[model samples]
Target: MNDTVVPGRGDKGLLRNRVVEVENLTIRFGDFTAVDGVSFSVRKGEIFGFLGANGAGKTTTIRMLCGLLAPTSGVVRVGGLDFDDGGNGIKSIVGYMSQKFTLYDDLTVGENLDFAAGLRKLPAAAAEKRRAELFGMTGFDRPLTAKVSDLPGGIKQELALAAAMLHDPEIVFLDEPTSGVSPAARARFWGLIRRITAVGKTVIVTTHYMDEAEQCGRIALMRAGRIIALGSPDELKDSAFPGPMAEVDFQGSDPAAPIERLRKAPGLLALSPHGMRWHAAFSEGALMDAALSALPVSVRVRKIKPSLEDVFIRLAGGAQ
Candidate 1:
């Protein structure tokens, strides 16, 4: 089977091994349109990502995918199951972890697990087995008696993930799973996420962190409730900045004048301030020559590859 990721439209036949397929998906609340004709398909065992700013419809689209909310219009399918059956089949094979904390803070680690398993109607022995298996997979050795309220943010998020996966769903949807956690904790959580994918399960994640989004096999960048760009990380980077790019550091000098000057330079398509420096994308070498000729001698110009943040800023950050 060909494992090509395609826009979820036109072709009626399913893409090879596609676990999730959405076609012209749109959701509206009163007059506000949350998701506007978004279409995408996900491959099996792939780490698919949804990226966007606040209210860009990442969560709203994910909610429709998880069968949490019905779409106002368009076709939706998850794990090869259509919504015609009232999403019962779709819900059975998917796990959803919301961006907000959904676990009961008053409960203990084991209690939370039990509560989640009970919701899925898992038996005592099955829940226990899955718990041990998940803990082993995640290297999570926190005591079952520990209160969730007292646990660290990282630990709590991991526990919540464990609860969501208690039923061993085929597809897992994690909405902003690593938000508001330490870098170390986020790294560790992604490690566990990698392990989950290693076992051949599909993961659909929505995250704000560029580094985390880089881990996705393909990313759908959303803006104004629509997919503005969709491709692999490298593909998106190339599409956003197809020509040579450079990072210009002012060498402790004021960048205000140089920024204004480069804005009018020939061959330069984009010039945006990134951190302490400026990233300039040009159609050719004329911009670099212009920078060297017009800018102060203290300035430093070095060629560099574009990162996912660069693409995000260019494509989804409203204006660069």
Candidate 2:
């Protein structure tokens, strides 16, 4: 279905009052190009995701957007300000939370917040007010004097996010925010993300987790420093496989034999084992039915919806 369009290839009209705009963005170090002419725009107050495996240039892109790293060539605009103009003032209106926790572990939670506020150069009175508001919203019931090093993993993540948003920036950048957290912690963290976006703050996050990618308003799948696909979760899934998908369970001695046999067929686009069953995609209509009939009658087949993982595998041409 050719879902591998360049980033922001088709959805230009839908992007109104964009909070971030990048055109022909490229970054290079010596001879290696980390980002290659990527183009995409992020809408205001929406969650934009960069979905890909490690070393796919997600962190590099985010760093460029946050003004920490300079792009070799491109047009980048954030909050109606040009990135080429040094982007010094842009730092005040944009918040960034890196993959690793950046706060001082030796200090108390309150002290960490104070340090962050100082870095932002906020006045003491304004910083106090913001601290009160953040603590209230985050339900930071732990003693402000408690050392950050002593907090639980989930609490540490929450505290990191709180520090990022202490200044109430209009735009937020979260780089792999849930890298080592548990599923329950991830869920709770995402809930916080939802509430933050609900209040009119734009969010740009990078993650390899498919479930987390599904939560974004839109996602751009990156591969080898390039965007191969971009769309909402449903749109990507629909365009990923232009055929019928089915989950099959074979009541046979060797599932491998049946899968290997099916691979040689003309209509089969992809076939892969899922536990005791197999998930396959085939050309629509007659071809699909024909492929199904070729399987042994002892097999059980049921049509199923394609998942994001399936879509990625098919688009990446790694189907098996």
Candidate 3:
């Protein structure tokens, strides 16, 4: 019924490896608070994720963590260096791939990488060597002469990832990397992300897809620019609905009587319409059993697992 923040779980060794830390981080734009008093830490080699609807400040928080925008308040540390409104230490260890495709359409694949290397100021030989390694790492089979516009959405996505990793930054920030790619492509892109962690690099990604969010080791759910829930997917779900859930569909067209009647039912935790049916959450099995029995026999009640959407609806006040 309240914000869920579970203590860190899984792999004891990794739990101690804190790579990013933030405390009371906040930023405002005149009369608006884009990111409010948020605090969380990311472990080394962890796939940390931020999930929220638009205007929830997911990007604003990411920007602060990446040192692109200095926070109005709070302490931030990346790789154990105090990032108190500084970019020097942050830039050397963080790679970023934005939600939008950043490669030049007219330029060839090689040219794009070259441009990225120039921006990073990598030497000619070092840039070439890193390119070869990244190509092998991402399974990039496309020829260097291939134009960016000629490639598919998935391929371009991978290219963007490769370019982000060109400098071998310790942490990678992926902002909706697979937003428009096919499901298979999304799956493949995730695999690439997994490999990045396998080799001991940390990743912080923001995704709208619930399934994609499930892949994260830990998640911070944001609402109104504040993290309402912080935990793994299962932890958040269990904490959100510490009871039974049921989907009920009325047999008759006019079912207002039962709907209004159940609103005041004792032990009823939540009741709301979801499309053609209504979803209900009860404090326990005893309450759920009694509630179901009190409903009209013509109505159909099916128990269901609580999902992230359910968590969002219950926690964020409404749908995004």
lDDT (tens digit, per residue) of candidate 1 on 1-320: 21224554545454657888888899999999999999888878889999999999999999889888888888887877767777777888999999998799999999999999999999999999999999988878989999999999999999999999999999999999989999999999998888888898999999999999999999999998999999899899989988888989998898888789888888887777887998888877766666556878898888888889988988877362
* Candidate 2 Cα deviation (angstroms), residue 114: 0.4
User: How do the residues 1-320 of candidate 2 rate in per-residue lDDT, one tens digit apiece?
Assistant: 21222355447664545888877889999999999989888888899999887888999999888888888987777776656556676677899999977778999999999999999888989988988887787677898899999998878888898899988999999999898889998998898889889989999999878899889998988877888888888999888777889998986657777778878877787887777888888877578777778888889999998888887776654721
Scored against the true structure, residue 70 in model 3 reaches a CA lDDT of: 86
**Greater-TM-score candidate between 1 and 2:** 1
The TM-score measured for candidate 3 stands at: 0.90
RMSD in angstroms between candidate 1 and the native structure over all alpha carbons: 3.3
What is the TM-score (0 to 1) of candidate 1?
0.93
Q: Sort the candidates on TM-score, descending order.
A: 1, 2, 3
Of the candidates numbered 1 and 3, which has the greater TM-score value? Answer: 1
- Structural similarity to truth (TM-score) of each candidate: 0.93, 0.91, 0.90
**Candidate 2 worst ten-residue window by lDDT:** 1-10
The digit string of per-residue lDDT tens for model 3 on 12-33 reads 6654688888778899999899
Once superposed on the true structure, which residue ranges of model 2 sit more than 4 Å away at CA?
Answer: 1-15, 317-320
Runs of candidate 3 with Cα error greater than 4 angstroms are 1-16, 251-255
Candidate 2 accuracy as lDDT: 0.84
Residue 154 shift from truth in candidate 3, angstroms: 1.9
